[model samples]
Target: MATPVRVTRLCRLVGRTVSSPSARHRQAVSLPARTCFISTTTWKNLLFKLDERTAHSSLDLFKKDTGVIYRMLGLDPTHVQDNPERFRDWAVVFGNERISSGRHYWEVTIKKSQEFRLGVAEAAMSRDDCVGTNRCSWVFSYAQRKWFAMTNGKTVPVTLVGKPDRVGILLDYEAGLLGLVDIENPRIIHAFKAQFKAPLCPAFGLWDGELLTHSGLEEPEGLK
Candidate 1:
């Protein structure tokens, strides 16, 4: 197991909970048991045992059937896609595939906002299945044979059927495969102005979805 980096301690705000500075050094530190709010930095800060053979063996299976991996996580990963552009702004979409074990199981550093919008079929089948390098984010449109770099909400379209398989796989890792499909908010004001602005507007205060709770487990309509 990889040792965690010194977790920064935050102050306890009226509406927030924070760790004591000493909590960082507590052996078997007590964190919320039912939460999934793991930081990406945590993964990068730690290391685990993963080699080329492990990833290579799983690549074919993931390319052929990612659902099996999804099932392993006990998540019902049906084909659900949400277009970020449809709602406007920096929308981020992701799809999940098998990743390495522990520590850096997945390394997704999305400096730019993204929209989760494709599926295994869309990602794996497309020649441009992978678009941008893990160094940055990218967009993919399987049907249109379109792929491009997405940074700072700016898009750069590209057509690359000539890249190596490593590019596609790594891109997929950098871009989290679509996690939970229905868990989303309409980012575009115009997308739902008429429908949501009325008296019957849906709760717009807190995001309503499956997010990490104070504890570290999955729950319906996660922590408020």
Candidate 2:
């Protein structure tokens, strides 16, 4: 098992939360979980897992998939600006997958994005609040050429040896751990130790560029 790494020296960032959700917002929240998947030749690969043999033998673990790819579609592009479920005035969205047990791993390709936040948040987290700015979520964010680990309005600066193009996320629900990895550089960015009390969905907040998700991945050897 991978050991949990605790984030330290956190300082509070200014934030706000909405106590009550509107009826339309509540309705949108009730929509069934939607996951995006693309196929090449075979398989209905919305989400995937590796077979024992391939998983045990692979060195290029992140790129090698079992003929399937899972993607995350953020929101209705036409209605994104007016979307009631958007996080306050920000462009934030959550993936449909709700994780409550065992271990899970996924990656997000940050394509030309100048500012973005990626991580997990409780399904019931307030849409009016930003991810990692409250107790219900945890995230690793990049803005203005700086990196941070944030939760509950607290932010911790992250020092990285190399820039990240693709980020790896590892969630061990039972262990109450959330780890963020820098894939290109093969190093851990930060890990938040928490007593997760509810099911979590992949949460993201983006400003300028695209965020592509690659799911159904095995935990990286370095994380182990």
Candidate 3:
């Protein structure tokens, strides 16, 4: 059976602080390229910024809990009630940038890693849905001392050599691949391949503990 997931939690509480945002809903940052690449096993050097889409109305609880005055004040209560993008049963944040082409690399460090999910989702991914449960998203999740690669409502168990403090994500957009790496041990935990159809946003879900993002980084030399 596919592992049932609840996209809810403390609601995306950890990330670098940003300036107070406007009341209007924020959109994904546009990418410069649209051409996909031919599939290749060789990785390329890439760097990209990764910032949380902090204006989300669904993250009010997180703001309140963390006492981030800026975010608390920035909450659009009106939008919370009617915003089509507001998540009713789940809480996650997407990166401000979108990926439509080229290769991209980033890593997330898990602090008190109890239960968290990280991966990519199309910009149009349903606010009411969970990542990896639909065609529009793919993820690597760790929960209950177990790890799995999930997408399209299917789950594949991932066996690791040891607990990893950081997980690396490699997205080959045109080549259609998503890989999760065990940074400490320098090994791939799992990878998913597909013909990506739309621009993707970095997506994260956390219930307890923190997931810190490290972006605009060199692709790990060991993974090359």
Candidate 4:
């Protein structure tokens, strides 16, 4: 979904994504507005320095196997993952910044996207979101602790919507723009903000019209 041309085009037109992020693109490379401030030293973190190393690592992810990642579109996983060129169009809006107010920039993005088209769900936590609209998406059920991804369209960006440094991850199904948390037991769909868990099944495919079936989706087979 992300290409160098696309990333640049979106960055130029869409501008910043996260409603409120620690590190932000400023008109003047000085500091963010006071209302955008979190603390006195917040500027230090907000104004994150995008060094070559950090930039390199983010790019590396696109090349690495990252078995945990699953690209539903392209029909093949290698099309996105293991292919750095695919992500060139994407810009690291937030490399690693702390948001004292919102649920980190990633979470903020998840929330915003969810509100715009979809929503987040987690039983323990009220609700969380990550990743936004994708070219496509296909929802499915979790059966184990294995990482997962899906699509409802031709392609959708699946992003990890967890805090900068925390476990208990979930996928922001951009195609569907839905925040889906993996139920510890794999058979529960946790509500994003309700912090409540509901019993689900491993074969619980997304609702298809008035019917429930795994019709147009495939399992997250990870890297080749």
Question: Which numbered prediction scores highest in TM-score against the true structure?
Answer: 3
Locate the minimum summed-lDDT window of 10 residues in model 3: 63-72
What lDDT does candidate 1 reach at residue 33? 25
Which TM-score value belongs to model 1?
0.21
Query: Candidate 1 overall Cα lDDT vs. reference?
Result: 0.20
- Per-residue alpha-carbon lDDT of candidate 1 for residues 175-208, written as tens digits (9 for 90 to 100): 2322211223311111100111101000000011
RMSD of 1: 21.6
lDDT of 2 by residue, 1-224 (tens): 23323444332221232244664564324333433222322322224432211111101122343221212332233332333444443345666556666677788877557677788888767655667767888998887687778888777777765456778887777888888887765666678889988777777666555566788566667774
Order the numbered candidates by TM-score, best leading.
3, 2, 1, 4
Backbone clash count for every predicted candidate, in the order shown: 23, 0, 1, 25
TM-score of each: 0.21, 0.64, 0.67, 0.19
State model 3's lDDT. Answer: 0.62
Candidate 3 Cα RMSD (Å): 8.3
lDDT of 3 by residue, 1-224 (tens): 34544443323433332233342553333434534322233334443333333224434323223211123233444544444444434446666566777778888777555777789988667655666767888998787787877777777777775567778998888888899977776666688888999878777766555566777677766663
Error of 2 at 143 (Å): 0.8
Q: For model 1, what is the error of residue 160's alpha carbon versus the real structure, in angstroms, after optimal superposition?
A: 2.4
- Candidate 1: segments with Cα more than 4 A from true spot: 1-34, 40-65, 68-138, 150-155, 159-224
